[model samples]
Target: MAGSADTLFMPITNGEIPLGEGQWLYLGARAIDGGFPDELRAALVCEQSMRGAYLDLQMRGMNVSPRVDNTDRFSGALILIGKHRGENETMIARASNMVSAGAPILIAGDKTSGVAPLRKRIAAFAEIDGSLAKYHATVFWLRNSVDFASHFSSAKTSPQGYQTSAGMFSAEKIDKGSALLAEHLDENIRGDIADFGAGWGYLSAELLNRFSPRTVHLYEAHCASLEAAKENLSDYDKGQISYYWHDLTREAVGKKFDWIIMNPPFHEGRKTEPQLGVQFIEVAARSLKPKGGLLMVANVTLPYEKTLQQNFSKVNQLARRDGFKLLKAQL
Candidate 1:
């Protein structure tokens, strides 16, 4: 579904999938080539953060906040299933509930994303209207009904005290790189701080445990993960925390900080995009005071040293172990 337009749009193009006369909802809608037709009233519910997709959606003037206040009211819905099984199931469940009974809810995904099992699973419970195959992907529609709500609303089980959702960086446990950086953090990290891509609040919580910074901003791109981070760090004083569900690469950080710490994401879909971390480095540089410091961890193989050197006045490697490297970049 990443680059294949036909998977979701073919039916609409071929006139098999009819757009609602009123509003329709899009769940986890990735980069649509040119976005939906002008006539269609599309509402988006995207939780994951792909910088390019966010840019595309923003350019289309469809930058709806991921947190929709009143849900389960759209006349029809379309879900672009992602690679995470739990996320896919949760989106499908939310999609099913969004549209009413007998309204269309189309699920689109490629073969490699485990679309077959999901199709079968939903077919067993929901009323399958029909399906079409193209570009090694399947697009199937099921009539919305409350009868199957509990089955598909979400994937249930999580280990004890887990505070993350599916598809987030280090969702299941503390990331090794983050953990290493947290362990080796300077004892005097006490000024205005920012965690660039704070995932599920692990490093933020660690920072709060160690120091009482004036303010700790948690900038995360994924809405669900941001929500989880909120819960994970709920016990902390309100004034000490600021959470921003934002596109780190495309958006400005608003204010400069005394220090920035992160384990920046280096992935774009199924590919390793080292430039992602590069962009984060650039953003950190722009959002930090001249005397500020940046502490981050990365995979040993990711090529970030040159970018770090170019952006920071001083860059040094603090530690390297377990296939991860910890670096400090000072302005």
Candidate 2:
């Protein structure tokens, strides 16, 4: 189960702990409203695309960095543990390594998110000073200590030699939908190509290995996925590939592509939001040259046909199997 933003911020709302002054790093903070304190120098670290929600915060004059990572090394960190065990462990371990030896770290999550077990795991590196239980959530604090770098070693590699990290989409194996999309990809596909929501470079790797496009641009929102993609695609000609940690909903590549391929995500966290996929279609339409084409795969239930027909001069269903449908659209 996923924890709500309210549950994650309950400790702060109840005045159990304060968002003190000085540099503060916030991990997995996807939502921020009046509940957040205004006094601290805050940096919001999130891998997902938050362009729409972040712009709202900016308009409200909230001073927070939209992106931050372990490299930022803030004086303190406010972490909201996620549902993925490996991701939670990695965040805590990295944050422990980044902060000063005696700096504070606060973690919060709901019971369903496994905060209790996470508290125990964190005890290996730091001492839990205090904890609060309210609103079906638990929040705890600790002082950073011990170098936990070893806990997060190199990303796991699959038998196929793809480097994948925990918590990324289809980390354990190549996604069936992506594999289906790959099977239908034409070997003659040439020219500059873009892969939206490219997870760990699976489709991009296939494109490079098969079509050998002149240049392939990969856009991914997740930092870890982007890192894995870099390692997995290292053998390809460096100049022929480009990677971007981008949010497609609110930003554009500023350059058009000859062909674009994607297995666009239809969900934001656990909720099914087909509009996110629609936005991707719209972005692909705008990013494609007048004669460019797009090849995309999505779940069968998603209402993307209307959006595709609206954006493309022609929409063709290429393949459908195992609850996924592949589409080919042209401008």
Candidate 3:
């Protein structure tokens, strides 16, 4: 959302969370195993923004979409909350819009995802039906009396002059590493460029404003962040920028670039996955021109140095500050 279910449908197994008969909206949906009610599965109009999860649902034969359609009417809803609180509320707001008052909105998540306080937060707005705790997780259903879901604004403009939506990394403020990287991008960086894992187009927007590149290819995994990137970088989209809603770890970019810049994500859920950043380095190594180079920022402790050295013919530490290190690698 393995590792995430085998902990949402527990309430369904027990009988405390009763879903409605017609199409049910499922926010942040993913593949589940062992004892998911088949009727509920059939009724679910599953919505997942992450490309990998969306494809996983499709592969499992579940009805899934990257985004929700307003035209669809749902009798009830199920939400599997994530680590971001604003994004969870955004999902709840959308679910409120899909179903009428008194329709059940069943929400489930682990404590690390902050289900306890989230329940309290929503209780201030709507009415709770019932709750259960299992597998270090909590599942609760609440009647959606607040159907209109009054203007919960999840989108905001950062001081960096770009639009960011909820759930994106560093949505409200510039990430310190990215800000440092943006400040330190090589003055000589020109021509075709790529921003791997571009979230809300912050780095790309900075690149477009500070330097003139022939084109900038932005690759991001999340649909919402990619959508925000499109909106944030609209001015540069005339011909200077191209967006790809892609899982870069599993797929490679088609066109090679003169320079690749990134502030790669290392966290997968609560666990740190260094291999993801390694894969990103491999992608950058392959997707750059023979004489091209990479510019990136990362935490000083991340184990990417060996990967960089292994992939590129030459690697250097550009600068180190604010607990981050900037790297330059050329093939």
For candidate 3, write residues 1-331 as lDDT tens digits. Answer: 2434545666665666666467888899977865346786688888999988888888777888889885766888889999987888888888888886678888889879999988887777666878887777888887877743463444565656667777889988988899888988756788899999998888898888788888899999998899999888888777879889899988768899999999999999888888889999999999999899999999999989999999999999988889999999999
Judged by whole-model lDDT over C-alpha atoms, candidate 3 comes out at 0.84
True-vs-predicted CA distance for residue 209, candidate 1, Å: 1.2
Give the per-residue lDDT of model 2 (tens digit) for 1-331.
3344556555555777665545666666655434445553244443332345555455555553444544656677677776777777777776776677777788888777888987887676567888877667788887776665664443554637898866789888888899999998886567999999998999998888777788999998776687889998898856989988788987777989999999998876567899989999999999998889999999999989999999999999989999899999999
TM-score of each: 0.87, 0.80, 0.92
Best by lDDT: 3
Per-residue lDDT of model 1, residues 266-302, tens digit only: 9776678998899999999999987899999999999
In model 2, which range of ten residues has the least summed lDDT? 40-49
As a whole number from 0 to 100, the lDDT of residue 10 in candidate 3 is: 62
Question: Per model, how many backbone clashes are there?
Answer: 0, 0, 0
The lDDT values for all models are: 0.78, 0.77, 0.84
- Candidate 3 stretches greater than 4 Å from native: 1-7, 34-38, 147-157
What lDDT would candidate 1 get against the real structure? 0.78
Q: What is the lDDT of residue 327 in candidate 3?
A: 93
